[model samples]
Target: MKYAPELKRSATIALWLILLTFPIMVIQVNTIENIVVWRWMNIAGVGTVAFVLSFLWQIYQHRKTESPLPVSAHLPAFQRLLADPKLYRPMLIFIAAFALVFPFTASHYQINIMSTALIYIMLGLGLNIEVGLAGLLDLGYVAFYAVGAYSYALLNYHFGLGFWTLLPAGALLAAFFGILVGFPVLRLRGDYLAIVTLAFAEILRLVLENWNALSFGPSGISNIPRPGLFGIELTLEQSAVYMYFLLIALCLLTIFVIYRLQHSRIGRAWVALREDELACQAMGIDKTRAKLTAFALGATWAGMAGVLFAAKTTFINPASFTFMESAMILAIVVLGGMGSIVGVIIAALAIILLPEYLRVLGDYRMLLFGAALIGMMVFRPRGLITPSSRTYVFQPSEHQERT
Candidate 1:
């Protein structure tokens, strides 16, 4: 049976409902600060109560009505687009503009927040390559990040190497590490793979903390040099706002690389490997090579981000490369949609920037954040921007009929 086409005049109100229910509730939670005097525990307590009440009310309404809240109200194609941007052009411009002017804010706090956001954006895109494009569940992503940051920091500290010289080297080293990681995990799947990756990240963190001779042993390498641009050494005098442009350029370059790779021959092979490894191998696709390449490429991107991060922070500690960091990066990728670069970028922004910006709400922030994440996942499991059930329809092969 054919699915009914959406009516011409109807609108897609599903998203609006979600935004209204969760985001507006967040606004309310922020608004009612006086209702909770203790602040920290108060907000959490209040939000929890409110959520329970709302949930109970929902149950009550459903029991009484014997129906869902609302039906689908789809708009015509042109009208549907009017609510959203025209694919990625607007998003690209949105990203460029935000990255460009965000640095110019008079507030140092904003600049600091945005710098973190840019780093996460890079991290999200890198993880998107592995988990999103290749369908690999990696929990040890921090190892590559650690590898890159440490490689750059140690190289510069020991050899007086410049940031530019060490960035590529760090990426190459991370890629090497990625190959090492992939070899043993070829047979692991799902939760098992995630556990192994998590173990790897923890191991890297422990090594960094314990290896005093090489890693400086938890004291961490401090006073790291920032990247110099065009022979001009970036100093405190350069202003945090100005340095942001360098980050913007780096992000744009990362975006370009991802775009090229997504449309490349290797990208196609990775997608094939993602869909089904046995089938990919049967089709003469070297599944091993494809998986390895995906890992390497993903690691390379994270490594580069780590190099930039080392330069940006000018200090590193074992604490920064913890498993939580890996989980946060993975959360942005998964919450944003695995294969969608734009979704990852948006998720990165929301995850990093939104929490900081919402700090004005004070104690209620994390409570609202947890609620928002849960609501987002419940409403759109695929991600914030990614479509659900977009199938890759391949025509029947000559050997398929016989099989």
Candidate 2:
């Protein structure tokens, strides 16, 4: 009797889902043959799945409310395992070994996919600094990415600059653009800031798309040349291997730098600003500098990743830097757990590689992916690994002890 209301609610939800999906799932039209096919079974299937999912969701919510355990007890098992050094250290070592050997053993196609995943990891971490640490929501991070790529393409086309030379140049140019965008949005926060950043990115993309002479228009620049190794020429396969190793090195460097920065004084300022802008300002932290630094530093990694992206693909196009790219990068950060270095890496790999591996399911792969994401959001809103709180221990100084 007590469960009757819950059951009714679930039924209602299932019915709604069936009604919503009826047109798409239950009916198929053949225009050439002038035929309409009805799959009534799809209605039953939708209802059953929706009912079961909704019922399970309600039960989970009920249990959560009734449970005697503290809120911390609900932390995800993966996060708990990560907190134990005994587990995570060995896991890290094993993963590192695998990553190093992966390029050698995996097929060239797989290596390329892994390289793309690494690039996203770089992008995720960079955005983490801005959105996760600084609480600045940037919807146009791909703009900086485009800047780095196009910088390499244009400079190489006209001035004959090499990858090694343009790598740092691309990053610097992106950082300069970051500062330029940051200056206008220093006072904006939340949605307003996101809008401004997104606008900036769109404007850049439009310029590149329209400026035929400068960017070569929609055709894009091709044969941009892969990264050279000490003036030595290499075959295509060898070049892929080199690019894979280069990405590994860059990802490591990015992780190290971000980890260090996360624990630094300026990093603390960013966190404080994120938590409370008014309070942070009251504490004498320079808000303008913090905001600008966050934007520039965060964009720096994207710029570097962009250079590598252009080199690996040996091409540059405005279409590649669309809003969807930004959304995916943002999804990596959010799904991984904001402000978590390890979480972002894990999320980036999973999000990028899962679809490739699930291609066996063909069209249904994305359906499964979408369902998984929905489940995650419903069950674990904080992400796979919640960022651990900073712990400080007090130790008496020698002078105080003497006194």
- Which of the numbered candidates is closest to the native, going by highest lDDT? 2
In candidate 1, what are the lDDT values of residues 1-403, reduced to their tens digit? 2212222111223333334455333433435565522234434444555555455545555554775434333222422443466665675688567666655644776776777788889889998889988888999999999999999999998899997889899999999999999888888877898899888889889989998999998999999888887786555736466556667777888889988888788887878777888888898988778888989999998998889888888899899998878888988998887787767887898988777877999997887888777877875687865533335889999899789
Model 1 lowest lDDT segment of ten = 1-10
Alpha-carbon TM-score of each model against the true structure? 0.77, 0.92
List lDDT for all candidates, in order: 0.78, 0.92
TM-score of 2: 0.92
Q: Write the per-residue lDDT of candidate 2 for residues 280-383, one digit (tens) a residue.
A: 99999999999999999999888989999999999888899989899889989998989999899989998999988999999999889888777777776888
Residue 55 lDDT (model 2) = 93
